[model samples]
Target: METQALDFPKIHAVLRTNGTGEVTINGTSHPIQADDEAAVLREALRLITDTAAHLGRPVKVTTTDPDGQGLIVVSPEGHVSEAAPAKTAPRRQKAPAAAPLITSVPEAVPAPAEQPAATVAAPVQTTPTPAHEPDEAKQPVTFASSVDQSQSPPTAAPEQSTRRSLKETSFLVSAPVLEPAAHGWRGILTKLGFRMEPSAEELTEREDIRTVSQHWPGPRTVAVVNRKGGANKTPTVVMLSAILARYSGAATVAWDNNESQGTLGWRTEQGGHNNSVLDLIDSSQTLLSPSTNAAEIARFVHHQTSDKFDVLRSDENEEGDHEVTAEEVDIAHQVLTRYYRLIVMDSGNTARSANWRQMIHHTNQLVVPVTAIEDRAEAARLTLQTLESRGGHDAELARNAVVIVSESTDSKRSMSGDALKRAKAEAQRIADGFAPHVRAVVRIPYDPALVNGPIRYEALQPATQRAWLAAAAAVAKGF
Candidate 1:
């Protein structure tokens, strides 16, 4: 066996093995066993090929064997030649000098960057020869013609095509001159996007109304409230608490203000608690003694769902167990604000109740759920009236107070065309009556799912039920 050295400009050697039976690259040896020789040869050829490619230069490998068979080829420009001969004649040749010629030509001649004076003059002073002359003589004539054609000014075909397209588009868009009546109709049609008629329901719902409230820093303390019972206020509070817990992952406290009945805790599965809101109110005298630590007062609050929310249950036996003096309510509110990011109170419908007044005053939002029936409408009106009386009439509160119409049937049972019309008229009258006093009045259509007590956020109808969640989000935005 003989050894031969090959130069590869691009690839650098990473490893090599002993050259006895097998040679390795950078200590990675391969035995010349069975078909291993072919693999080694292939790897070596690949290395040279890659090296040539990287260096941008060609390489040639040859073995000293008598067969001249183990030969690898690479091009000077880093290209591999699989079949081409390794040695070939040179391709470059020197140009011969020629006499200068000049001739008349058009504008826009592209002069060479460093053309000699002789070359520049040759094109300008070319002699005009006959086109039908011998091949050798016609060559110069053809060259001169090509030079002249290249220098000639370009025709404006592109500009003409563009102008034609613009003219065609303008013609298609142009309206015919019309009579006064026809022109007016056409203008109206155009303004209405050519729709002859649009849905009345769509038109009425087109006006997008958004809720606005004062931005309160720290935890978003929302009160789930409605003056009237069966308005799904308790269910709304439960679902809102779950949604708030799911969204914020922060601890929330659901205060059961239904003193007459522990409905909130019962519905939420947090019943059988002795230290209810009444207990807190009874103990407020000692708890709110200016000397009592606010943090300690917060500890009396019981957790309903571990880290999620704390439940403040009301006494079921006592008639007015949740009732508290104004001072206790004020102190409790201050302590709650310090401990919680949110405080959702399930308020009763009685407008005369102290809890109702306190909740309306301290709440960031007053969610008033009403039924489509006349009685529920009256209750909603009263609830709104009570809130306005307590908080003072303001545009923001009026607009932010969500009047959700619960227990509505999708089959038009209660929302018949006449009933809907009446409801609309009543809603308008209510809105108009409280104009400038109520900020906004939104109607949440009744969802059947809410009838089965409190439902999760995901269970509610996405289109209609979202009004409540949107209202909650709007209320949260204040924080």
Candidate 2:
């Protein structure tokens, strides 16, 4: 076999050892005997060479799992020896990008004094699975196998909450009429007039959906927040609520909290009452009364006929100079919480406002949405940082937050598929950094229908709808 181009100046292997104090390789415990040790050493060397060969250089390997991790060095001749304990580097402050996917050799390993400068270089991260993620979501994209340095016993990987695929759906329902005699179960069922319900391929339950469904806690608040305007906050709230409502068959509402002029109300059904959240608060006495229930609450809110969720419009009256104060929000929160199974907030751009701060405090899960634009991303980063520094009610929000990178670019411009892929890849790259800080990252591709106006999931194209489902599933898992 050709030599792999792994030009690493240093390499260290962190291995799991049995009670007998011998390292296991490929399921054999304590490969201490000549043959077993040789096999273990050979496998380790093969892993390194294959990894280095892919990069066409000497491979670097780093092991910094602090949970009783054992380390060893592989000689060029394929001999395995214990790594110096004191010589090991300090705890890894941050894992490299490729740490999630490709091989990561630590700078902890000491290189021979004669090694050249070109050999000791930057770590090669896999367009790697993830920096903060465990198992890099457990299935790091088939780049290569990575040695798990965790000292804990092996566990099953958790399912991914978001779908990362860019491929469009190809499954289409055929005409209800059976073409000919049935062959398979689908055709036989179709011939029996069962095609209308469970068609040839319904493909209704998606991976993201199944994952999210596993963690369904009823009645929670998800705040769609970003300090930057036009970051698709309202759209994010609408789309996510629609997706959750559709799947969970639960009552969902999008509450717009803009202090001044806001547009979420403009896009949703105005309902029977011209009333907004302010009106709901004003009638809080009756709304929150023991006699009142969800049906009565709908009179004050807008209900979307096409979509199952409701909308609580912001104070849209220009004359009142209506700014929703925390007290008013509290009243509405009390009522809305009682009635709605999920309350998604379309928050304002002002992070400093009392309303915004209160929303963050009450938020069970934070969903920070940002467009692909640089400034918007910066604003999102700032928002997360501010939440972290706030320290009171919001410090943990940044840690448990879901960062949704939305593609607000107009699809009408007709960008190429490759360009779209590049954009998605960039979004994933940003999300990789966020994986360590937030619970998960969700990406919503640009949908022309959602770019502006009222959002109806039915009106969305199949691809757009799929994207929303994936985004919502990501958030549902966190809940």
Candidate 3:
């Protein structure tokens, strides 16, 4: 077994952005920089500590040596360690970029809105091998991503690559030594160096980074459904669209499939053109014409300028009394499907609507989103029940669905641990039933920024971005 441990050196961990790309901490702004993962990791821990304090929670982020090289840990009941920096700093040299790396994550379960908001998934288990352990047991497992060359980063391996090639062949080989940075925020008073055992928060952050970096081939449809929709569906569409577009950089679209007035356009950025799905339906003949192209079709859909997905909004005018028909939806869907790799539909409240049912029927993967509220959760349950009872393909769609339980956008303001845990349990109970019938279950914690109007992935806190990234990764598996 080759060693999986590589000296990370002084790395800078940036708070991942959704729409915008900056991470700020302790009222001081930090731009995403080109430093190693360690510095960024230290900063990330600082961000977590800051967020917990802002939420008026007792969670604390502590390091063994406040001024020495040590490890950082966060705990609600004060079970964290603190350390000081090394008195005589060890001289280190920069090593060459390590070999291409890939990670596999267990499906993550996000804590409910009220659980001190610790992390994404469990931390990458880095418990050191005991001195007496056999060497062969140390070899790690590897897997490849399925995205094409264009979508793959420079470091990503080809799809046909195997774990054997990914394994480290030289356990004792020498590499250039990299000196840890001695200045800047990485040299903060509370600097905690690296440790063999990582905190759970650190593990979740590492997993989120790997998840967001992956890419996959796709031309898939994701429906965010909740029959009792008042405001949830549009955000789900926007968030999923943003995260997917952010990570994959693939062409993605979000269509507001509301029968009547829908708020998707209002919540997202609107284009200069007042064109809606109606315009697309009227122009489908030309758009779908054999000679037509992707750029040409962009004229009808609303493009979310910041996040890279298009929006086919429903008619939002109060005076407009038009209800979309099933045939029109098929026309619009076909047109979008031709040009975009992913389409996320924000549906109306009617489960019986022709377009709504059609969405479920044609959906590649269904995403049933519910808030902690009872009525909202019930609506999600009923929608799944309706599909299960309907049989045939609908049952299959229900079976392969991804259930998402989210905190209300404004949930943080009134959150209490006991109340939050109860809400999470309820949401999990709903998710538990579908566990047998679904592909994945994702939970999203509350983010105040997403509650208002437009969502800027950049403006969200680190924790918010982590949650979204984790949820999006689960959905991307279906792709």
Candidate 4:
């Protein structure tokens, strides 16, 4: 190509290694291999060029072979011509004159001559001045021009400007403009006093606020745990992460704390297995340091569908029983607390582990997924009892813990008449037993697609998904 001055700050260099050597860009891992180096460099260059062009700048490139040297030039302006085109400056113009004022007057009456002295003598009158008098002969005098004399024509007043300004000042001194919609039936009861019931739009807006409140991080860390397989914990974690991402727009991590092979990583479709929480803990132990930089740890994790969510994969090796330790979990909490607005621990079932209990202790909310089955209800109750026995009796834990019944097909769990009745009774018992401490007992109906793979939020059947989103909303409300 023709030579031209580069107009961008810098052009990225793609280092290609012959074998398994690591590639570093600006002292950071390149995150790609030699086989893909050309393509990566091309893509990076394309992005840089597009950005420079958008900013009216230029980016240039240089290449080299196996050895350590090459030259590349970039310009802050993307001009390629030998001589940059001269920019034609804009010219100023005079402002137009204001519109003229017009006033109307009634016709004047002629003066009546005096009939006095019975002789109606000719009225003495002064001679009028000639129209063509010379300047020197005429008296030098000035009169206000009609253009300046007439008061500006009355302007129509704006209707609400004054009222709006008053309202704005009152708001500044007294209250915010966008206050929360009133709550409960009292709002409906007091409609005559301007305490009207929230409109549909207002209710929708309140729901959004509630959703935001649920996911924001506070003083406590929360983990959603279920030890049983096929409990929908992974999907729950993913959806929760998506919601948190949508709300916070800050760093949020979904940790696949399950040491055993799990689906958290698979759901996000990220491939690397070399770096995970397990690796981090192991590296920390070997280094003998308290590592708490989230960006550093984040470099090893995978990004989920949303930019806000990151994933820490489970151990890939099937036979590996390596579990998260109490110390490691604490370290993770300390590190995560500094960087993330919300950290979602997808700790798969295996509540028997000491580490799992520690995870629960660190969390602000513990979501336990139960199916609407007799056995599942019994198991859920037993799990609650276990939590109570393990020192989860504090008001915070009691109030924050939730048991969600999953896979409800027809609002009932079992086919047998007696079993169905028992299931309903069990649900009520669970709700009643956990009352005051537990916020609500919710249900998630059976959706076959969830088991197979991730589904789009919009594609889910409205009835089932709406209930799920409502449950999510409830979860958010508790937080």
For every model shown, the clashing-pair count is: 27, 19, 32, 20
RMSD of 2: 20.0
**Against the true structure, candidate 3 has what lDDT?**
0.60
Sort every candidate by lDDT, greatest first. 2, 3, 4, 1
Tens digit of per-residue lDDT, candidate 3, span 228-262? 86537777889899988877787889998988878
lDDT of each candidate versus the true structure = 0.47, 0.63, 0.60, 0.51
Cα shift from native, residue 94, model 2 (Å): 51
Instruction: List, residue by residue over 168-282, the lDDT tens digit for candidate 2.
Output: 4333322232232243465576577532223323344345666554535557889988999888788888888777877777788889888765788877777888888887888
Model 4, CA-based lDDT? 0.51
User: Candidate 4, residue 452: CA error in Å?
Assistant: 1.5
TM-score of each: 0.44, 0.57, 0.58, 0.51
Residues 1-479, model 4: lDDT tens digits: 11333422333343332221222222222233334333343333333344344333334433221222234332333222112111122211221243222222111221221110011112111123356866345421101000112233323435544234544343121211233236556465444443333556557656754675453435435577655665567777776666656664656778877746777877775734457776756655433345544446655677656335778777776667776677878776665665567777887667787677678767777776666555655565566666766663433564567767654434233256665566566656655655555666676655554555544454456656555665656666656
Worst 10 residues of 3 by lDDT: 140-149
Task: Output the TM-score of candidate 4.
Answer: 0.51
Model 3: residues >4 Å from true position, as ranges? 1-218, 411-437
Rank by TM-score (best first): 3, 2, 4, 1
